[model samples]
Target: MTIAEDRAVELQEQIRLPRSMRLRLTRNGLTLVPITQAHWTTQRRIASQIEERLPGWTAVGEFSVIPPREGYSPEPDVSAVPSDQVLPDASKFQEDLLRFVVEVVSPESEERDYSTKSDHYALRGIEAYLVVNVLTARWTLLTRPQGGTYRHAVTGDFGEKIEIPVEDQTLVLDSSQFMRV
Candidate 1:
Protein backbone atom coordinates (compact mmCIF):
# COMPACT_ATOMS: atom_id res chain seq x y z
CA MET A 1 0.00 0.00 0.00
CA THR A 2 1.07 3.58 -0.55
CA ILE A 3 2.22 5.73 2.34
CA ALA A 4 -1.01 7.69 2.20
CA GLU A 5 -3.08 4.56 2.21
CA ASP A 6 -1.18 3.27 5.21
CA ARG A 7 -1.76 6.57 6.99
CA ALA A 8 -5.44 6.46 6.13
CA VAL A 9 -5.75 2.98 7.59
CA GLU A 10 -3.93 4.08 10.72
CA LEU A 11 -6.15 7.11 11.15
CA GLN A 12 -9.29 5.12 10.60
CA GLU A 13 -8.18 2.61 13.20
CA GLN A 14 -7.08 5.27 15.68
CA ILE A 15 -9.88 7.77 15.53
CA ARG A 16 -13.44 7.10 16.58
CA LEU A 17 -15.44 9.69 14.77
CA PRO A 18 -18.98 10.53 15.75
CA ARG A 19 -21.86 9.34 13.60
CA SER A 20 -22.42 12.88 12.31
CA MET A 21 -18.77 13.25 11.33
CA ARG A 22 -16.80 11.83 8.40
CA LEU A 23 -13.11 11.14 7.94
CA ARG A 24 -11.59 12.09 4.61
CA LEU A 25 -8.09 11.55 3.25
CA THR A 26 -7.23 14.58 1.22
CA ARG A 27 -4.02 15.75 -0.46
CA ASN A 28 -2.85 17.27 2.78
CA GLY A 29 -3.83 14.51 5.18
CA LEU A 30 -6.81 13.22 7.12
CA THR A 31 -9.68 15.53 8.01
CA LEU A 32 -12.79 15.07 10.08
CA VAL A 33 -15.76 17.27 9.29
CA PRO A 34 -19.10 17.55 11.00
CA ILE A 35 -22.33 17.29 9.09
CA THR A 36 -24.43 20.32 9.83
CA GLN A 37 -28.22 20.18 9.85
CA ALA A 38 -28.43 22.26 6.70
CA HIS A 39 -25.98 19.98 4.93
CA TRP A 40 -27.93 16.92 5.93
CA THR A 41 -31.26 18.32 4.91
CA THR A 42 -30.00 19.45 1.53
CA GLN A 43 -28.28 16.14 0.86
CA ARG A 44 -31.39 14.17 1.75
CA ARG A 45 -33.57 16.28 -0.51
CA ILE A 46 -31.21 15.93 -3.43
CA ALA A 47 -30.71 12.21 -2.91
CA SER A 48 -34.46 11.66 -2.79
CA GLN A 49 -34.93 13.67 -5.97
CA ILE A 50 -32.27 11.67 -7.80
CA GLU A 51 -33.60 8.32 -6.63
CA GLU A 52 -37.12 9.29 -7.63
CA ARG A 53 -36.05 10.33 -11.11
CA LEU A 54 -33.56 7.58 -11.81
CA PRO A 55 -35.37 4.32 -11.22
CA GLY A 56 -32.44 2.02 -11.98
CA TRP A 57 -29.87 4.02 -10.06
CA THR A 58 -29.30 4.09 -6.32
CA ALA A 59 -28.67 7.43 -4.69
CA VAL A 60 -27.20 7.40 -1.25
CA GLY A 61 -26.23 10.18 1.14
CA GLU A 62 -22.78 10.53 2.70
CA PHE A 63 -20.92 7.34 1.80
CA SER A 64 -17.22 6.63 1.46
CA VAL A 65 -15.90 6.37 -2.07
CA ILE A 66 -12.56 4.58 -2.26
CA PRO A 67 -10.80 5.84 -5.32
CA PRO A 68 -7.79 4.10 -6.85
CA ARG A 69 -5.59 7.14 -6.34
CA GLU A 70 -3.71 7.43 -3.09
CA GLY A 71 -4.34 10.15 -0.47
CA TYR A 72 -8.02 10.54 -1.29
CA SER A 73 -11.11 8.92 0.10
CA PRO A 74 -13.93 11.41 -0.30
CA GLU A 75 -17.40 10.91 1.06
CA PRO A 76 -19.64 12.80 -1.23
CA ASP A 77 -22.83 14.31 0.16
CA VAL A 78 -24.70 12.31 -2.46
CA SER A 79 -23.40 9.42 -4.54
CA ALA A 80 -25.32 7.59 -7.24
CA VAL A 81 -24.42 4.15 -8.51
CA PRO A 82 -26.08 1.55 -10.68
CA SER A 83 -28.58 -0.47 -8.65
CA ASP A 84 -27.65 -3.72 -10.38
CA GLN A 85 -23.91 -3.38 -9.65
CA VAL A 86 -22.95 -5.72 -6.87
CA LEU A 87 -20.62 -4.13 -4.37
CA PRO A 88 -17.48 -6.03 -3.48
CA ASP A 89 -17.67 -4.56 0.00
CA ALA A 90 -20.84 -3.26 1.57
CA SER A 91 -19.06 -0.66 3.67
CA LYS A 92 -17.14 1.05 0.90
CA PHE A 93 -18.18 2.00 -2.62
CA GLN A 94 -15.42 1.75 -5.19
CA GLU A 95 -14.78 4.82 -7.32
CA ASP A 96 -15.42 2.94 -10.58
CA LEU A 97 -18.93 2.17 -9.47
CA LEU A 98 -19.80 5.81 -8.84
CA ARG A 99 -21.59 7.40 -11.77
CA PHE A 100 -22.22 10.75 -10.12
CA VAL A 101 -21.18 12.64 -6.97
CA VAL A 102 -22.53 15.78 -5.36
CA GLU A 103 -20.90 17.97 -2.75
CA VAL A 104 -22.95 20.61 -1.00
CA VAL A 105 -20.64 23.52 -0.29
CA SER A 106 -20.49 24.69 3.30
CA PRO A 107 -18.70 27.67 4.79
CA GLU A 108 -15.71 25.56 5.84
CA SER A 109 -15.60 23.44 2.66
CA GLU A 110 -15.76 25.97 -0.13
CA GLU A 111 -12.23 25.47 -1.37
CA ARG A 112 -12.34 21.73 -0.87
CA ASP A 113 -15.56 21.47 -2.81
CA TYR A 114 -14.82 23.91 -5.64
CA SER A 115 -11.15 23.07 -6.24
CA THR A 116 -9.79 20.02 -4.46
CA LYS A 117 -12.76 17.73 -5.06
CA SER A 118 -13.22 18.84 -8.64
CA ASP A 119 -9.63 17.87 -9.51
CA HIS A 120 -9.70 14.67 -7.52
CA TYR A 121 -13.04 13.43 -8.85
CA ALA A 122 -12.07 14.24 -12.42
CA LEU A 123 -8.77 12.42 -12.02
CA ARG A 124 -10.61 9.39 -10.73
CA GLY A 125 -12.75 9.46 -13.89
CA ILE A 126 -16.04 10.04 -12.10
CA GLU A 127 -18.46 10.84 -14.94
CA ALA A 128 -20.12 13.81 -13.24
CA TYR A 129 -19.42 16.02 -10.23
CA LEU A 130 -21.90 18.63 -9.08
CA VAL A 131 -21.08 21.41 -6.67
CA VAL A 132 -24.10 22.94 -5.02
CA ASN A 133 -23.31 26.23 -3.34
CA VAL A 134 -26.23 27.09 -1.14
CA LEU A 135 -24.48 30.18 0.13
CA THR A 136 -24.42 31.71 -3.32
CA ALA A 137 -27.53 29.96 -4.57
CA ARG A 138 -25.60 28.61 -7.53
CA TRP A 139 -24.49 25.24 -8.85
CA THR A 140 -21.66 24.03 -11.06
CA LEU A 141 -21.72 20.83 -13.09
CA LEU A 142 -18.44 19.34 -14.26
CA THR A 143 -18.47 16.70 -16.98
CA ARG A 144 -16.27 15.06 -19.63
CA PRO A 145 -13.41 14.19 -17.33
CA GLN A 146 -10.10 14.19 -19.22
CA GLY A 147 -6.46 14.88 -18.46
CA GLY A 148 -7.17 15.09 -14.74
CA THR A 149 -9.71 17.86 -15.26
CA TYR A 150 -13.18 18.40 -16.59
CA ARG A 151 -13.39 19.43 -20.22
CA HIS A 152 -16.77 21.05 -19.79
CA ALA A 153 -18.39 22.97 -16.92
CA VAL A 154 -21.81 24.57 -16.70
CA THR A 155 -22.72 26.98 -13.92
CA GLY A 156 -26.12 28.45 -13.13
CA ASP A 157 -28.30 29.79 -10.38
CA PHE A 158 -30.27 27.52 -8.09
CA GLY A 159 -33.58 28.15 -9.78
CA GLU A 160 -32.34 26.85 -13.11
CA LYS A 161 -32.07 23.27 -14.31
CA ILE A 162 -28.87 21.23 -14.29
CA GLU A 163 -28.81 18.43 -16.82
CA ILE A 164 -26.46 15.55 -16.10
CA PRO A 165 -25.80 12.79 -18.59
CA VAL A 166 -25.73 9.49 -16.76
CA GLU A 167 -25.11 6.41 -18.85
CA ASP A 168 -27.67 6.23 -21.66
CA GLN A 169 -29.99 8.85 -20.19
CA THR A 170 -29.98 12.43 -18.98
CA LEU A 171 -30.90 13.19 -15.39
CA VAL A 172 -32.56 16.58 -15.14
CA LEU A 173 -32.37 18.03 -11.65
CA ASP A 174 -34.60 20.93 -10.85
CA SER A 175 -32.81 23.23 -8.45
CA SER A 176 -35.63 25.68 -7.88
CA GLN A 177 -36.02 24.90 -4.18
CA PHE A 178 -32.37 24.51 -3.23
CA MET A 179 -31.46 27.10 -0.65
CA ARG A 180 -29.76 27.67 2.67
CA VAL A 181 -32.04 27.25 5.65
Candidate 2:
Protein backbone atom coordinates (compact mmCIF):
# COMPACT_ATOMS: atom_id res chain seq x y z
CA MET A 1 0.00 0.00 0.00
CA THR A 2 1.10 3.61 -0.46
CA ILE A 3 2.38 5.53 2.58
CA ALA A 4 -0.68 7.79 2.60
CA GLU A 5 -2.98 4.79 2.47
CA ASP A 6 -1.11 3.19 5.35
CA ARG A 7 -1.45 6.41 7.34
CA ALA A 8 -5.15 6.62 6.50
CA VAL A 9 -5.78 3.12 7.82
CA GLU A 10 -3.81 3.97 10.94
CA LEU A 11 -5.88 7.09 11.53
CA GLN A 12 -9.17 5.30 11.00
CA GLU A 13 -8.13 2.89 13.69
CA GLN A 14 -7.08 5.58 16.15
CA ILE A 15 -10.20 7.70 15.88
CA ARG A 16 -13.12 6.67 18.11
CA LEU A 17 -15.89 8.88 16.78
CA PRO A 18 -19.12 7.20 15.72
CA ARG A 19 -19.68 6.15 12.11
CA SER A 20 -22.60 8.57 11.86
CA MET A 21 -20.48 11.51 12.92
CA ARG A 22 -19.34 13.92 10.26
CA LEU A 23 -15.59 14.03 9.66
CA ARG A 24 -13.05 16.46 8.28
CA LEU A 25 -9.51 15.87 7.07
CA THR A 26 -6.40 17.58 8.30
CA ARG A 27 -3.30 17.72 6.14
CA ASN A 28 -2.20 15.20 8.72
CA GLY A 29 -3.70 11.73 8.48
CA LEU A 30 -6.57 11.66 10.99
CA THR A 31 -10.39 11.81 11.20
CA LEU A 32 -12.22 14.19 13.51
CA VAL A 33 -15.74 14.62 14.86
CA PRO A 34 -17.53 17.85 15.56
CA ILE A 35 -16.52 19.61 18.78
CA THR A 36 -18.54 18.97 21.89
CA GLN A 37 -20.13 21.79 23.85
CA ALA A 38 -17.27 22.06 26.31
CA HIS A 39 -14.74 22.04 23.49
CA TRP A 40 -16.78 24.59 21.57
CA THR A 41 -16.91 26.97 24.52
CA THR A 42 -13.17 26.93 24.87
CA GLN A 43 -12.67 27.32 21.13
CA ARG A 44 -15.07 30.24 20.90
CA ARG A 45 -13.47 31.96 23.86
CA ILE A 46 -10.00 31.59 22.43
CA ALA A 47 -11.09 32.76 18.98
CA SER A 48 -12.71 35.86 20.44
CA GLN A 49 -9.63 36.55 22.49
CA ILE A 50 -7.39 36.28 19.44
CA GLU A 51 -9.61 38.55 17.40
CA GLU A 52 -9.54 41.14 20.18
CA ARG A 53 -5.81 40.86 20.67
CA LEU A 54 -4.96 40.84 16.98
CA PRO A 55 -7.23 43.14 15.02
CA GLY A 56 -6.37 42.00 11.50
CA TRP A 57 -6.44 38.28 12.19
CA THR A 58 -9.41 35.91 11.87
CA ALA A 59 -9.96 32.96 14.15
CA VAL A 60 -11.82 29.86 12.99
CA GLY A 61 -13.33 27.12 15.07
CA GLU A 62 -13.32 23.55 13.83
CA PHE A 63 -11.88 24.68 10.52
CA SER A 64 -10.65 21.69 8.61
CA VAL A 65 -7.23 21.91 7.02
CA ILE A 66 -7.48 21.26 3.31
CA PRO A 67 -5.44 18.29 2.26
CA PRO A 68 -4.48 17.11 -1.23
CA ARG A 69 -6.64 14.01 -0.91
CA GLU A 70 -10.09 13.33 0.60
CA GLY A 71 -9.23 11.46 3.82
CA TYR A 72 -6.84 13.27 6.21
CA SER A 73 -8.29 14.89 9.32
CA PRO A 74 -6.10 17.24 11.39
CA GLU A 75 -8.70 19.91 12.03
CA PRO A 76 -7.74 22.21 14.87
CA ASP A 77 -10.30 23.12 17.53
CA VAL A 78 -9.42 26.73 16.84
CA SER A 79 -7.29 28.29 14.14
CA ALA A 80 -6.08 31.80 13.37
CA VAL A 81 -5.21 32.94 9.87
CA PRO A 82 -4.44 36.48 8.78
CA SER A 83 -7.61 38.32 7.72
CA ASP A 84 -5.98 39.37 4.47
CA GLN A 85 -4.85 35.88 3.44
CA VAL A 86 -7.55 35.12 0.94
CA LEU A 87 -7.81 31.71 -0.63
CA PRO A 88 -8.95 31.16 -4.20
CA ASP A 89 -11.98 29.36 -2.76
CA ALA A 90 -13.58 29.94 0.63
CA SER A 91 -14.93 26.42 1.12
CA LYS A 92 -11.73 25.40 2.93
CA PHE A 93 -8.51 26.97 4.17
CA GLN A 94 -5.03 25.84 3.26
CA GLU A 95 -2.91 24.37 6.03
CA ASP A 96 0.18 26.38 5.03
CA LEU A 97 -1.61 29.68 5.51
CA LEU A 98 -2.70 28.88 9.04
CA ARG A 99 -0.87 31.07 11.58
CA PHE A 100 -2.04 29.25 14.69
CA VAL A 101 -3.90 26.08 15.64
CA VAL A 102 -5.44 25.27 19.04
CA GLU A 103 -6.62 21.88 20.15
CA VAL A 104 -8.58 21.07 23.30
CA VAL A 105 -7.85 17.57 24.48
CA SER A 106 -10.64 15.27 25.56
CA PRO A 107 -10.38 11.68 26.78
CA GLU A 108 -10.96 10.24 23.32
CA SER A 109 -8.64 12.73 21.61
CA GLU A 110 -5.65 12.96 23.93
CA GLU A 111 -3.25 10.74 22.05
CA ARG A 112 -3.84 12.12 18.57
CA ASP A 113 -3.66 15.79 19.58
CA TYR A 114 -0.49 15.37 21.57
CA SER A 115 1.31 13.03 19.25
CA THR A 116 0.06 12.52 15.72
CA LYS A 117 -1.42 15.98 15.24
CA SER A 118 1.66 17.67 16.61
CA ASP A 119 3.86 15.75 14.22
CA HIS A 120 1.62 16.63 11.30
CA TYR A 121 1.47 20.35 12.15
CA ALA A 122 5.21 20.44 12.56
CA LEU A 123 5.73 18.64 9.29
CA ARG A 124 3.52 21.20 7.59
CA GLY A 125 5.51 24.02 9.24
CA ILE A 126 2.66 25.51 11.27
CA GLU A 127 4.05 28.37 13.38
CA ALA A 128 2.12 27.84 16.63
CA TYR A 129 0.11 25.06 18.28
CA LEU A 130 -1.76 25.34 21.56
CA VAL A 131 -3.24 22.41 23.45
CA VAL A 132 -5.80 23.13 26.15
CA ASN A 133 -6.81 20.33 28.44
CA VAL A 134 -9.96 21.46 30.21
CA LEU A 135 -10.18 18.26 32.18
CA THR A 136 -6.75 18.88 33.65
CA ALA A 137 -7.11 22.63 33.66
CA ARG A 138 -3.72 22.93 32.00
CA TRP A 139 -2.44 24.32 28.71
CA THR A 140 0.59 23.66 26.57
CA LEU A 141 2.03 25.69 23.72
CA LEU A 142 4.32 24.34 21.04
CA THR A 143 6.26 26.48 18.58
CA ARG A 144 9.34 26.58 16.38
CA PRO A 145 8.81 23.50 14.28
CA GLN A 146 11.87 21.79 12.85
CA GLY A 147 12.34 18.38 11.29
CA GLY A 148 8.71 17.36 11.84
CA THR A 149 8.72 18.30 15.51
CA TYR A 150 8.40 21.31 17.76
CA ARG A 151 11.59 22.66 19.25
CA HIS A 152 9.94 24.59 22.10
CA ALA A 153 7.04 23.71 24.38
CA VAL A 154 5.67 25.48 27.44
CA THR A 155 3.14 24.08 29.90
CA GLY A 156 1.20 25.90 32.59
CA ASP A 157 -2.05 26.23 34.50
CA PHE A 158 -5.22 27.42 32.79
CA GLY A 159 -5.32 30.82 34.42
CA GLU A 160 -1.84 31.80 33.35
CA LYS A 161 -1.39 34.19 30.45
CA ILE A 162 0.67 32.98 27.50
CA GLU A 163 2.83 34.95 25.12
CA ILE A 164 2.46 33.62 21.56
CA PRO A 165 5.32 34.89 19.44
CA VAL A 166 3.72 35.53 16.05
CA GLU A 167 5.92 37.18 13.48
CA ASP A 168 7.99 39.78 15.41
CA GLN A 169 5.46 40.73 18.10
CA THR A 170 3.88 38.57 20.75
CA LEU A 171 0.15 37.91 20.88
CA VAL A 172 -0.92 37.50 24.48
CA LEU A 173 -3.33 34.59 25.05
CA ASP A 174 -5.48 34.91 28.11
CA SER A 175 -6.40 31.47 29.31
CA SER A 176 -8.24 32.86 32.29
CA GLN A 177 -11.53 32.75 30.39
CA PHE A 178 -11.29 29.07 29.54
CA MET A 179 -13.93 26.96 31.25
CA ARG A 180 -12.94 23.69 32.80
CA VAL A 181 -14.26 20.46 31.33
The numbered model that scores best in TM-score is 1
Model 2 spans > 4 angstroms off? 1-34, 69-73, 86-89
- Per-residue CA lDDT of candidate 2, range 1-181, in tens? 4677666656765767763353544444344565566676787898888888976777776455776433454668787777888454564678877866888887667887899788888877888889999888899899999998999999999889988876666789888888887
**What's the distance in Å from true for residue 131, model 1?**
0.3
Q: Which residue pairs in model 2 clash with each other?
A: 25-72, 25-73, 26-72, 26-73, 26-74
Cα deviation at 115, candidate 2, in Å, is 0.2
Q: 50-138 in candidate 1: lDDT tens per residue?
A: 88888789887656677546556777888788888745456578888887899998777889998888888998899999999887888
**Candidate 1 lDDT:** 0.81
Worst 10 residues of 2 by lDDT: 20-29
The alpha-carbon deviation from the true structure for residue 162 of candidate 2, after best TM-score superposition, in angstroms, is 1.3
lDDT of 1 at 45: 81
Question: Which pairs clash (backbone N, Cα, C closer than 3 Å) in model 1?
Answer: none
RMSD of 1: 2.2
Q: Give per-model TM-scores.
A: 0.87, 0.78
